[model samples]
Every structure is written in structure tokens, then in C-alpha cells.
Target: MADIKLSGIRKSYGSSEVLHGIDIDVKDGEFVVFVGPSGCGKSTLLRLIAGLETISDGELQIAGQKVNDLTPSQRKIAMVFQSYALYPHMTVYQNMAFGLTLGKKGPLGGLLGGGENKKMIEEKVHKAAASLKLEPLLKRYPRELSGGQRQRVAIGRAIVRDPNVFLFDEPLSNLDAALRVNTRLEIARLHQELEATIIYVTHDQVEAMTLADKIVVLNDGYVAQCGTPLELYHQPANKFVAGFIGSPSMNFLEATVTDIGPEDIEVVLSSGKVKVRLPVLPGDLALDARVSIGIRPEHLQEGSGEVFRMSSRVKVVEQLGEASYLYLENGEDDPFCNEPFCVKTNGHSSIRTGDSVDICAALSAVHVFNASGIALTRTTTDSRYIAPRRA
Candidate 1:
């Protein structure tokens, strides 16, 4: 097992800087995932750590050794790519043995020396195949294996190298959805068995949520939020993270403050005529101060709750079979600008059409933000926004 450390690591291409100075410490035998939208420097950061891309600045250490000046081969790191990168013509055994054979040639040249060394290499190959469940097709070629099996072979090849650290760049991206789930479970099991430190990169949030022990959320070449899945969901630092991490996404509304109190603040929708009291004090906010309110779809209900309530024109209704989402449009110039605010209603609410109806939002479930979108702390009204605990 190894602990990987990156301090002030940076990379640049001419005038465009891709990775800002990033400091991350990956604990020994931990699975850390780097996740973000495409072109966000996740892959670049992986390449820099693997020595495939030279760092424009900063340091990378593997198992307490500084490897910045080392070549990819000298770094003793094994990487698995999205394409699997297997040689099509070589048999499985030959492919697995290729790297070891090449290393032997640089020194003792195993076969030219003795049969015992070759036997030792074969034993290690067999052991790795067993670990990945690839022993059945050791003699078969790459064309004989399924996408998942080919990936297993790729992982097997990495295992045979026996490096201190394992790096994966979206290794399961090529598989279909169902296969992806099965392989993910297999990988989870493999990690426990090997107890190896792994660094993985993926754009799929669900994959990051499920597989990573710790998730690093990146955006625009910088770290947005880093935490366990629940932390990012329940307590987002900014609006961008609040909107991005959830499934149906959070709801945003522009409104004018109409009432202020020591314990609660009331605001009217910027769309006009509609007002709702939220779970925050109106202190320091001007009487007519314009602030935005954020609430998750799950926090809304068609029926009344302990706190705030609203009314709007139903623009679009979607029944997800498991749950329901109703979009409401308030009176405004641009339809989307006065776009339908979303609410998570019952799977069988049975409410439909031009329903100028009232909706209730529990005071605790509401998140109040200032003009600049900074989230305020928990208030008496917000005390009710309790997260559903996982059993």
C-alpha cells in the first residue's frame, strides 16, 4: 500500500493554465475519485501524477518518495486507460507477460538465464488472473473477451506489474450501463482484497457517489468541493455545488424581501404578487432587498407544511413513476426567466392543468442566499430541513 501526496501541483500549456496549484493527500489504501465536467483537468491531473505529462510546477510523491524528476517507467506506477489499451494480436498470457519480459531483458534476460525465473513470472501471472477472475481465458486473445472481461485483463496486467499505486482514467466508460454496475461492484471487492491505494477519474456523479471513499469535485480547473457524498448534498458551500450534486437539482427563485423579523424573513417572488416567509432573519437586509431562495425538489409538498407556502401556474408536469416533478411559471416577460420552479410532489398527487394552487415548503427545508449567492447559516425556520438518514 502507498499514500500519494500532491502539493501545489500545477500544469500549463503555453498561456493557458489547466490545473491550478492543488494540494491533496490520498491516505494509504484509500480510494479517492477525481470528478468533474469534461475539460476540467481531471485527466490532466492523472497524467501528471503518472508522469505521462510533465508538471509545469509543483511536487508529486508516491510512498514518501518525490518522483517529479522521474520518467513514467521510473516512477513504478501502473495505469489503466479507458480503451483498455491491450494489444489485439497478442494472447492474454503474452500481453500480461510483456512488461515483465521487457524489464528482464534490460538485465538478466530471464529465458537466456534459466527456466526457474520464467516459471516465477508465470506464477505471478496466474495469481493476478485469479484475483480479477480472468483465469478462464488466459490462453484466449483480446477479441475473445467481452468489454468487462477485457477490462479485467487490463486490470490484471496492472496487478502483474505489482506497482505501489494504481491509476485509472475512466476505466469503465466503455461498458454499457448494466455491465458498468457489475464491474463497479467487482472493483469495489478488488480494492478490499488488494488493499491498494487507487486514484480514479470519472465525470459520472453517481459513480463518484458510490465508489469513492472520498470525492473531489472539480470545476473550471479548480476544486469546487471535497467531501463525502452526503456532505456535498446536505451542506453545499455555494450555489454551483448545491445545484450540481442532486438528482432533480435544487430550485432557484429571485424575490424581493417584503417582511423582516428577528427569527424569520419574508420575501415576495421577483415575479411579483406572490410572497413566502423563509427560515432566516431579515436582519441587515434592506426592506426591499432582492435575494435568491434555494430549495431542493424533495423539500416541497403540494400540501401545507410548518412554514412557507407559494402559488404559481403549473407549466409542466412530469410523472417519474417513483416520484413526481411539477414545474410552475410565475407571471413575467421571459417564460424561462419566469421559468417554472420545480417541486417534488407525491408519486400519485393526481393534480394537473392550469392549477393555480398553493404549495407548502417546510421552513427548515428552505435555503436562503444573498445577492452574491452565499448561503446563510441554519436558522430557526431552517431547523426543519432534516435529511433522510440512510439505514
Candidate 2:
């Protein structure tokens, strides 16, 4: 296991800087995931750690050693790319043992002088194959295996190296949904057995939420938030993270602060009819100051329970097996502004398009962001209405 640390890490390509100064400390055997939209510098950051890209500035330490000048092999790091990157001409065993064989050749052209080296390579290959359940297909070529099998071989090849850190760059992106789930479980199992420090990069929040011990959310080449899944979900640092981490995204409503109290603040929506009292810290909020309110779809319920009720017109209704998404039509100049505003209802919901329904959002579920998009801390008035807990 290894601890990876990045202090003021920065990356640049000519005049354009991709990664602004960023810092992260990944503990030994911790599963840390880098997640963000494309062009957010997640992949760039991973490559810098893997020695694939040069760090323009800042320091990177792996296992208590500074390795900014080291090669990938010198860093003792193994990476699994999105593409299998396997040689079709080689069998599974040959592919897994290839690295060891090349290493035995040393810096010069001559091979290692003993039979023990070959035997050791064979032992490591067999052990890795067995662990990944690829023993039966050791002699099979890459063409003979499925996509998921190819990925396992890729992982097993990395395992044979016994590297200090494992880097995964969207390893499961090529698999089908069912295979993705199975491969995800297999990876989770591998982490448990190996207890290896892993840095994974993915744009999929679901993968980040399910697989990571800690998640680093990047935005526009900067670290937006870094925390556990529940922390980012319940207590986002800004509006960007608040809107990105959740499914269907959080509903954003424009409102102006009308009343500020010690515990709760009242705001009037832009639509003029809805007035809400949200339990958020009254930090520098003044009357008539425009602020945004965020609430998750799941938190908006049909009935009231320490909630702020509002009448909405259902523009559309989509029924999944267990839940339904109700798209509300709020009066606004641009309809797209309200596109993110929707409510998740129970599966058996009878509401339909063009129907008027009353939706209530629990006070604790509301998120308040100031004009600068910074989230204000929420005050918990009732324990029952605390932020939604992760299951």
C-alpha cells in the first residue's frame, strides 16, 4: 500500500493551463476517485501522478518519495486504460508475463542468468490469473475473450507487477450495463483482497459515489469539492457541486431574501406567488437580495411534513418502476431555466401532464446559495428534518 500526496499540483500545455494549483492527500490503501465533466482536468491529474504527463509546477510524493522526475516504471505504478491496450498476438499468460520478462532483460541486451527468474515469473502469472478467475483461459488469445474478460486480463497484468499504486482510467466504460455491474463488483472485491492504494478517474458520478472512499470533484480545472459522497450530496460547497452530484440534478429556483431570522430565512420566489422559509444561516443576507434555492427531486414530497408547500403545474410525468419524475412548468421568460426543476414521486403517482399538484419540500432538504453561488450553511431546527441521509 502507498500514500499519494499532491501539493499545489499544476499542469500546463504551452500558454494554456489545464490544472490550476490543486492539493490532495490520499492515505494508504484508500480508494480515491477523480470525478468531473470532460475537460475538467481529471484525466490530466491522474496522468501527472502516473508519470505519463509532466507536472508544470507543484510537488507529487508517492510512498514518502518525490518522484516527479521518475519514469512510470521507476514509480512502480500500474495503469489500466479505457482501451484494453492488449496485444492480440499474445495469449493471456504471455501478456501477463510480458512485463516481467522484459524487466529481466535489464538495461543491457542480456537476459537474467538463472532459471529461477523464469520460475518466479511463472508463479506470479499463475497467482494473478487464479485471483482474477482467468486460470482456465490462460492459453487463450485476446480475440477469444469477451470485453469484460479482456478487462480482467488487463487488471491481472497490473496485479502481477505488485505496484505500490493502481491507476484506473474509466476501466469499465467499454462494458455493457450488466457487465459493468459485475466488473465493478469484481474490482470492489479486488480492492478488499489487495488493500492497494488506488486512484481512479471517471466522469460518471454513479461510479464515484459507489466505489470511492473519497471523491474529488473537479470543475473547470479546479477542485470544486472533495469529500465523501454523502458530504457532497448533503452539504455542497457551491452551486456547481450541489447541482452536479445528484441524479436528475437539484431543482434551482430564483428567490429574493425578504426576512432574515436567527435560525430561518424567508424568501419570495421570482414567480411572486411562492414564499418559503428555509433553515439556512443568515449570513449577510439582506432584504431584496437575490439568492437561489436548491432542493433534490426525492426530497420534494406530495404531502407536507415540516415542509414548504407550493402549487405547481405538471408539464410532464415519466414513470420508472419505483418512481416517477414530475416536470413542473413555472412561469418564466425562458422555459429552459426551469428545466432542472422537477420532483420525484412514488411509482404509483396518479398525477399527469397539465394537472395541478401541490408539492412540499422538507425544510431541511432545501439548500440556499447566495448571489455569488456560495452555499450557506443550513441550520438544523428539527432532528427529523435534517439533511437527507445516504442509504
Candidate 3:
């Protein structure tokens, strides 16, 4: 496999610039995923790496070779798009073998004669099919296969090319929920077996968290943060990364600094009922300064806790299989300024809508952010909340 590097990459369309000075490194056999919201230029960045779009500025290297002017074929990268892009008339075997036969001259134009070349191509196709579990459907046409089967065929086609790098652009977006899960697992397994360098672009945070060895979060054509999934989730650089990387999103509550200590700062919520001592550096933060307190839904528990507590009326209760999300009304006077506080509880929670409840969270679970939405450096040394490393 090959390593890919992008330095100060920029992309523009006429007068408008999309990607601005993005720098990233993908080591050999590393699976790096670019994740962000819609219109974040993730897809455009992927296209630039695949040589489908020209870079307005900066350098791109593959396997220690500069390829700014090289064509897609010379870049040695295979792309699997959201659409299957399969040929309806051709069987799976023919579809996978088409890339090997392209631009072939008479007698196969190599040391291996025409017969030997054909055999070689057949072997490659069969091996790819076996790996993807598509051997049974090799003779079937695209129209006869299910959506998952068709997608597997597309991946198998790319495998036969033996590319130095693989590019996947929302490859599972078109599948159903169940199919997407199964296909996602299949792709992860394929990565483990092939150990190919891959760059994937997706708007789904769950996909990004579960698949990537490293995640680069983009926003407004700029790199917000780049780190492992757990690192981004537990220690976000700013409010955007913290909110975007987690499911059920983090809840932001208005608060003011009450006191500052050597290794922590104390803040009181707007309601004046909740006071929390957060383990963060008090960098230039003064007393009575306005700040935000970020707490994840999973961190908030019913009843009282050791650090902070809040009493709110439950507005909605969503009962999921393993857990339930409690949407509590913010006690603030102005409804427009805040969203309902959310708490995740056990699936068998007896709390119902319209019931008054007390929610609590530990000080270690709280994240402090400045008025500008930049996260403060946390001083807590606990690793319990961080996600486990991938096997």
C-alpha cells in the first residue's frame, strides 16, 4: 500500500473558494475518513485526491511521488461512489474483469501471451469475488442482484484493479439501514485483510467514528480538528467539533464564572440553582464572565449526583430499545435562547412526560467553553469516558 499526503491544498470554482489550505497525512495502510456537515467541502476534497478535480493550490503526493499533473489512472487510486455504477447487461465476472482488459493491444502486449493474460485476469477476478463473498453471484447480472450484492460487486471491481489507494464517497448512503450496517462491517473486514490505504468521505458521524483510524473534521472549507475518534469525542478543540462528533449532540447551558482556582474554575448556571467546579485551566477567565457548559446526554443521570443538579419538567420521552432520551424543558425565561435539556436513561425508566425530574452530572463530565465557542483545556486525567481503541 502507499501513503498519501496533502499539504496546503486549496480548491476554487471561479471566484469562490471551497477547500482552503487543508493539510492531512494518511500513512501506509491507514484508513482516514473526512467527516463534516453538508456543504463542508468533504466530497470536493475527496474528488481532488482522486484526480477528478484540479487543485487550485498546494501539493499532493502518493507513494513519495508528486502527482499534481498526473491523470486519475496514473494516480493509482480506485474510487467507489455512492451509486453502484454497474453495467446492467454485463455479469459480475465481466464487470470486474473490464478494468484488466482496458487498452489491451493484440496478443495482450506483454511477456504473458493472450491465453496466459486471460487466465491471470480470471484468477484476479475470482480472488476478489471470493473475498467479497460475491462468488455465488458472479454469473448474475446487476439487475438480478440485491442492492448490497450490487455494491459488493462494485467494491470487487475496484479490488481487481489492485490500486495503491481507495476512495469511498458515501458508499453506503443508498442502502437501507440494515444493509448499511452489514456493508459497513464488510468494508471494515476488507480493510483488515487488504490493509490498503483508504480515504473516505461521509456526513454521518456514526460511520466516521466506527470505521476511521483517524478522523479529520471539516467545517466551512476549513479543517476544524484532526484526531482519533475518541480524541475528537472526548477532547474537541472547539464547540463545533464537540457538537458535530457526537450523537444526540452536546447540550450547551449558559453560565457565568463564579470563582477561579489553581486547577479548576467554578461556574454558576443562568438559573442560579446549579453551580459546578470544572477541571479546566482558568486562562484569562475573570469572575462574572459569561461562558457555556457542555454536557453529553449520556453523562446526565436521573436524581442527584456528586457535582451539579438541575430540576426540569420532562417535555418528551423517546423510548429506545436499550435507552431512553428525556427531553426536558429549559427553565430559562426566554425559550428562543435555549434548547430542551436532554438526558439518556435506562430503557425501563419509569419517568413519563410532564413529570418533574432531577438530573445530575459529575464535574469531570462537564466541558467548559469560552464565549467564542472555543473549548478550554481540561485538567482532568480520567480516561474512563474516552472511547476504547479499535482492535
Candidate 4:
């Protein structure tokens, strides 16, 4: 296992820059995930760490040693790409053993013809095959295996290298729904058994939430937020982090600060007869300042709370087996959309489209964002509602 550190990292192509001064410290044996939308530089950053791309600026340190000039092999990092990238003509065993055959001198320096002994390669290959349950398929070609089986072979190939750092670039994206779930579990198990330090990149927030010891959310080439799954969920740094981390996403409504208090601030929605008193300090926000109120779909309950109340007409209702999502009509100035606001309700909810219903959220569940989209630090005089600080 290895610890990875990046300081003032930047990447550019011609005059356009994709990454802007990225700094992160990944602890040894930790699972860190980089998640964002397309073109957010997640994959580019992963490649930089793998030594597949050159870092235009900044120092990269692995296991406390500066490795800015090291090649991919010298970095001792193994990357599992999205595509299996398996050789069509070679069997699984040959493909798994291929890495061991490559020597610093040349292809001729392989175990079959050069320095490394045959027994060492066989031991590593058989161990990896057993670990990935690929022992039976070792004799089969890539084309003859199922997608999941081929994926296992790809992972097995990486496992045989005994890398200090493992890099996964959306390795499960190519699998079907069921296979993806099963493969995800397998990867999690492998991490626990090997205690390997892994840096995984993906656009799937669910994958990030499920697998990461720490999750980094990137937006427009900058890291918006990085924290544990629950920290990002319950206490986002800004509106972008709040909206991006949640599944259905948080609902943002245009509001105006009507009154400010020591431990609470009152705001009214622009196009609705709704007023909310949130548990956050006003700070530099003046009266009548435009702000946005963020509340997750699941946080908005059916009954009204003491601090907030909202009523809207339901436009659509999607009933999943576990819960129902209600799309309600809202104003044009709303952040998410013009017509409908999403709200999560009980699976057995009787509410239907065109029905008028009231929804509310507790003061503790509400998030307030200032004009620049930065979330206000929440504070409450009520000790019961205040969350304990992380040690």
C-alpha cells in the first residue's frame, strides 16, 4: 500500500486548462474515489497519477517519495481501464503472465527467454487466478469468456503485479446491471483482503458513495468538495456539492432573506406563499438579499414543520417499489427547473398528478446558499439539532 500526495497540480492543452491546482492527500491503504460529470478531469487526474500522462506542473509524491519523473512501471501502479483491453489471440493465462515477461532491457529479457525464472511467474499467476476465481477460465481466450469473466481476468492481471497503488478507471461501466453489482462487490472484497491503496474514478455517484473511504466531487476541473459519504450528504460545502452528491438531487428555490436572527434566518420563496426559518447565522447577508434554499427530496416530509411550509400542485408521480417521487409545479426563477420540483414520498402515497399537497422540512434538514452559491455555515441554539463535530 502507498500514500499519494498531489500539490498544486495543473494540466493544460495549448491555452485551455483542464485541471487547476489540484491538491489532495490519500492515506495508505485508503480507498479514495474521484467522481464528477463528463469532462470534469477525473480520468485525466487518474492518468496523471498512473504516469500515463505528464504533469505540466506540481509535484506528485507516492509513499513519501517524489515520483514526478517516474515511468508507469517504475511507479509500481496498475490501472484497470474501462475497456477490458485483453488480447484477442492470447489465452487468459498468457495475458495474465504478459506483464511479468516484460523486462527493463527488452521483450527478449522475458522469463521464457531471459532473466526472470518460470516458477516465479507461475506462482504469481496461479495465486491471482485463484483470488479472482479465474482458475477454471485460464485456458480460455478473451473472446470465449463472458463480459464479467473477461473483467475478472483483467483484474487478475493487475493483481499478479503486486502493485503498491491500484488505479481503477470506471472498470465496471461495461458490464450489465446485474454483473455490475456483482463485480462491485468483488472489488470491495479484494480491497479488504489485499489492504491495497486504490484511487478509483467514475461518473457514477452511487459507486463513489458505496466504495470510497473518502469521496472527491469535481466540477468544471476544480474539486468542489472532498469528505466522507455522510459529510457530503448532510453538510455540503456549496450548492454544487449539495446538488451533485444526492441521487434525485436537492431542490433549489429562489428566496429572499426577510429577517436575520442570532441562530436563525427567515426567507420567503419568490413565487410561492412559503416562508422558512433556517438554523444558520446571517453573517454578512443583508436583509432582502437573494438566496437559495436547498432541501433534498427525501427531507421534504408530507406534514408541515414549525419553521417551514410549502404547498404545490403535483405534476407527476413516479412510484418505485420502495418510494414515490413527486414532481410539483414551481416558479420560473427556481434553480432546478421552471415547472416542476421533485419530492420523495412514501411508496404507498395516495397523492396523484394534479393533486395539491403540502410539504415541509425541519430546520435542521434545510440548507441555505448565498448569492455566490456558497452554503452558509449552519448554527443552532438548540443543542439537540446540532451535529457533533468530527474528531
Per residue, candidate 2 scores C-alpha lDDT tens digits across 1-391 of: 7899999999999999999999999999999999999999999999999999999999999999999999998999999989988888999999998788766445455364332288889999999999999999999999999999999999999999999999999999999999999999899999999999999999989999899988999998899999888788888899999988989899888889999998789998787777878889888888899999888898888865645777767888999969999998865542224554689999999998998877887778889999999998998655543435545
Q: How high is the lDDT of residue 274 in model 3?
A: 71
Query: lDDT values of the candidates?
Result: 0.80, 0.88, 0.89, 0.87
Compared with the true structure, the alpha-carbon lDDT of candidate 2 equals 0.88
lDDT (tens digit, per residue) of candidate 4 on 238-355 = 9999999888999888889999998789898886467767889788999999998888888787866545677777878999979999998764533334535788989999999889
Superior candidate under lDDT, 1 versus 3: 3
Predicted candidate 1 versus true structure: per-residue lDDT over 1-391, tens digit per residue: 7888999998999999999988888999888999888999999999999999999998999889999999976788889999999999998988897777656444355545433367778999999998888888999999999999999999899888888888999999999999999989988887888888888999887888788887788777788877767767776666767777776888887777888887778887765655667767554787888787788888888866545776677777899987888888755542224435788888897878677657777667777777776666646423345433445
Regions of model 4 farther than 4 Å from truth:
103-112, 331-339, 380-391
Ranking by lDDT: 3, 2, 4, 1
Record all residue pairs in model 3 with backbone atoms less than 3 Å apart, i.e. clashing: none
State the local distance difference test value for candidate 3.
0.89
